[model samples]
Target: MLPGHADFALPAPAAPVRLNGRRPIPEVPQMNGHSEAPSANEVPPANEAPQPTRSEKPAEPIDVWDQRVAGALAFLRRRLAGNYEVDDFGFDPELTDALFHPMLRVLYRDWFRTEVFGVEHVPVDGGALIVGNHSGTLALDALMLSTAIRDQTRAERHLRLLGADLVFRMPFVSELARKSGATVACNPDAERLMSQGELVGVFPEGFKGIGKPFADRYKLQRFGRGGFVSAALRTGTPIVPVAIVGAEEIYPILADIKPLARLLGVPYFPITPTFPWLGPLGLVPLPSKWLMRFCPPIPTAHLTEHADDPMVVYNLADQVRETIQATLLELLEKRPDPFGL
Candidate 1:
């Protein structure tokens, strides 16, 4: 009270630390299961701080479409790596019913109205070589045959198409051919696929078949050196003569390879015989319809295992060629319109 101002008392003593909000720190035991309490002046080591858990990981955003696409890719990888049988290689009858039948219903139900004959020739199960005339300019024939096989036989066998070098030589086209199960027309590849109980389809004429002059339409071209025969004999696969009508008239070539075609490095130049240089409107197939028939299967089972005999291979090739040629002639004579609709 004797001090300067009695009313101005000293500051109240500082409040003690309130530890109520503080957590009870966990006791991290030492190697001996006992820990030394830290002193006021002690400092922790560099790595002594608590580490983050997996729950602390940042979230990665994913779009629904991307996730779906990834799932599909994983499924496909598994399918391709699994023991893929002919029926399981996306060629299953059920898969055909699901995807192909719908497409056919759209493309051919009432509009295309296809009629097939001699489809019974395709065996229930075994290797077979299908030799057919190729036209439609763009291999619509191949696609059509695939569709027919699925629909008629209820067999989901893929045709191992033997395409020309030009097929693999093209940029984007090569991938499309491969997706369609085409491979290079080499004996080794053909024989290997056939040996695996696969059906091998070949257009021996290659580009020569598709681009032949209108004057030579419907005429059988020379069979290539019996290479296919050698493969068939080696694998004991039967040969099925196939004749396709209505394809030749799809795009009738009037003119042949010009300088531009040579520049493009294609075998023969083509000008579809039509008006206005066959303007976009005229490119449609003439609605001639399509007829495909698989003739009787030519069995190689009787041929000796020593089918390496050149004469035997050649004779078999000639027989296949003749059978296909005769069938084509018969079909052409019998059909009223090319498509047989």
Candidate 2:
């Protein structure tokens, strides 16, 4: 302390120490030595020999075609369970011959030939509500639409379609619908599916489209009070407007059976050229050329808080209707056949 400043007071030492040996001692475990004492980190060369490595086996060769086949088979097994076996609906020759055979041929051969636009509009993984015009006698349009999505996009997202009450009541029809992945037209079921990121097909027209008089073919009936629009608004999903052509010409209903409908507990009774009197043969839908156009997705991301507003719902519904109507007009004028390229 005197070397720096005589006035400065010096701090006391932490602890008293005493010298033990002439040389400073080492602070570590004892090490075996043959020749001389070694400094820290002075490991022997033998101890530093490189470790042996296991040889990795060659990676198995891949078969891309095998993967595709397996994928298609697994997909068929899951979706078309009863389809292969005899379903709850007795042996459906018509469905087997007419629908499935054609579908398989398309899937294996021509399905890829069709062109699709605005696929990006569809969410890669979410519940999307697709509101479309129902046509082609029965909901054959729905079946093809589902098939188209699956075949084209490689999306296994089954369209949990909102089917009519009549479908469930019928013994055969109900089972087929269940196997083909369709459910009733209700909000609970729809929301549950959409929440799971599934695609849902809704024909808001319902009986109106199927039962619309022959004179009014292709003229879209009034879409119910923004019900589907509300569904989208509630779920906050993009609405895809699907316009279907060629369904109109199939079994055109020239007349209605209001009396028969009331008695049979069904909507308008169809008076086609060959139904009821024609018996089972009448059920065969006329092979009208079909075209399904999935228009651009309408964004719901922008509405902010007004998504729940009734006026918003109404406007959205009108926009969808107008879009479909315009698309239908364009399709009718341009396309040569019902099932256009």
Candidate 3:
């Protein structure tokens, strides 16, 4: 007898039961010459199979951590074997999707609590220029914007950013920039990318927009030379004006150290509330509620011949700048508090 069954005992048969070739079935009690079913309180016969109790549990689920580890190993193996491909512009889509985007998503989705709108205006395929306001001292808005488009869009298109020459001047930074699909901000590069049906992003305000004093936040800076407009016109690509809020509050520049900036051969050296005083800890961006809006695309296909026209370029650039400014104000109204949940 089993240990748990010590208190239980099976009743012995009164008469010898015979089964020549078939299994023996439990005999039911007879009442008035008719067979009666067992009562609810009655115990089943020893020959019957036991039913499962309510305490029994289902099988355990697979470990997601194990799957992630296995996937990471496979990715590493592929990278080690040189099995990945990069485009002519040194853009590695696989690396960008697998590695870079996932890391940025934590900041984009959770830390900043970003909200995106007007993704429908982004074309599923073909060329388009995304023009956005620049801020957040460190250019983190650019990364967030790229991540946003990829996450929100149906096709998950990559935004080819046009970075300042200073970014490519550094060694490791240049390689990472190229792999992440960023080139120098130039008309030739922009035109080529758009011609290839790639979505190119440009910040016309340059360092001036991001390095502006905190008091001047959300104010539109002068778009340099309207070069982005000319590029769009030359490629006949529509320009999608985007406005980003909350980035202004992340690293508000209280002052600028021009001497330090010149010494480092960089743009304005910002002095934020925490930065340089808090040292390395100051690098962490504040948890601000972010709002991004992509306005309707301004078609430039009809202005292809006017790509070289200064007036046409200036007007288009001004139009895009105004659209972004208006959208920023609207988004600001929607998000009353910069740090509100």
Candidate 4:
């Protein structure tokens, strides 16, 4: 209110304070039929209502299921009101959380009995590349990994998965995948997402890893051409080596129908113990205990632009694969049975 303008006004008077800035101490309710006397400086206003303390919680206990249902409803309302948030790649965050994430949560908890380690390695913010060995006759492992990120990470970060071209070419599957926060598995898409600070997930093993027979269960297939590495290098994203155990046992692909695949114009048609023989009923994934271990991130942001060079990418990809393989072996040692612990 000094030398600015004629409209400048004097500062408003401060709000009145009680008892010269000291609040009267509250009464101590008697526990043994004895009320304590007040001190000279302390005076309790008999009519003044007690205010809840900063550390105080409600007297009534909160129901856990109620809170979760309320949250989900609120989220759904926001989405219904067209206040939904989605990324450029068509990742509908609110819908995914309210709808699909719950389904995945059940599978992660009840079906898989999943245990996670090295969660601290995942950056609470910013972009990261999570590379894992893929399997399960289906890409159920990918969904499980996504569930792991949602469960393990403090931020409950959305993992923008890079999937094969075939994924985007399907009908309902394509739309579902896009809405579930997946995009084409290519260098450009991965780079763009990382640059925008998304946690990108890649299974370089592609269909090969998932299609491999039950005999080759945990043995990770080749990580293919190091394209994921190149994307990571170009975007300078930290690459987290994620090793998943127990996905291999889910469907347990026993044999493959090559003729059926050719007729369907698709990849190998898996014939699991229950699948084909059991028809659609086999689609239900077997309950298997799962472990997802995240090793320390291999930093690539500091590397020179040449990090995208084939040789550099090849080397980095090899390093990440070795790290995942070693961690997988260790997780296997720790896990006794696919269904137990």
For every candidate structure, what is the RMSD over all alpha carbons to the true structure, in angstroms? 33.3, 27.4, 23.7, 18.3
lDDT of 2 by residue, 237-332 (tens): 778887777778767887888998899888778888888768999886665555456677787756636656989988888888877887777556
**Rank by lDDT (best first):** 3, 4, 1, 2
Report the number of the highest-TM-score candidate. 3
Which residue pairs clash within candidate 1?
A: 257-269, 289-339
C-alpha lDDT score of every prediction, in listed order: 0.65, 0.63, 0.83, 0.80
Tens-digit per-residue lDDT, 1-341, candidate 1: 56776452221222111111121212222342223333211322212333332223334335544677996777577567773343222234333444445565444434444546665677767778888877756676776676666555636565667888888899877765665567788988888878777778888777778878777888877776878877887788888878887778777777785686789898776777662375876666666655566877778877848478888887777777666676677657655665444
Q: State which candidate, 3 or 4, has the greater TM-score.
A: 3
Model 1 — TM-score against the truth?
A: 0.67
lDDT tens string, model 4, 1-341? 56765652212222111111122212223352222223222322322434542223355335544777898788768777888767688998877886899899788877787766677788999999999999998899899889888866768898889999999999999989999999999888999999899999999999999999999988989989999888888888999989999999999888898999999988899988889878889998988878778878889987649665898999899888888887788778767777774
The list of candidate 4 runs beyond 4 A from truth reads 1-81
Task: List TM-score per model, in order.
Answer: 0.67, 0.65, 0.81, 0.78
Against the correct fold, how does model 4 do in TM-score? 0.78
Q: Report the number of clashing residue pairs per model.
A: 2, 4, 0, 0
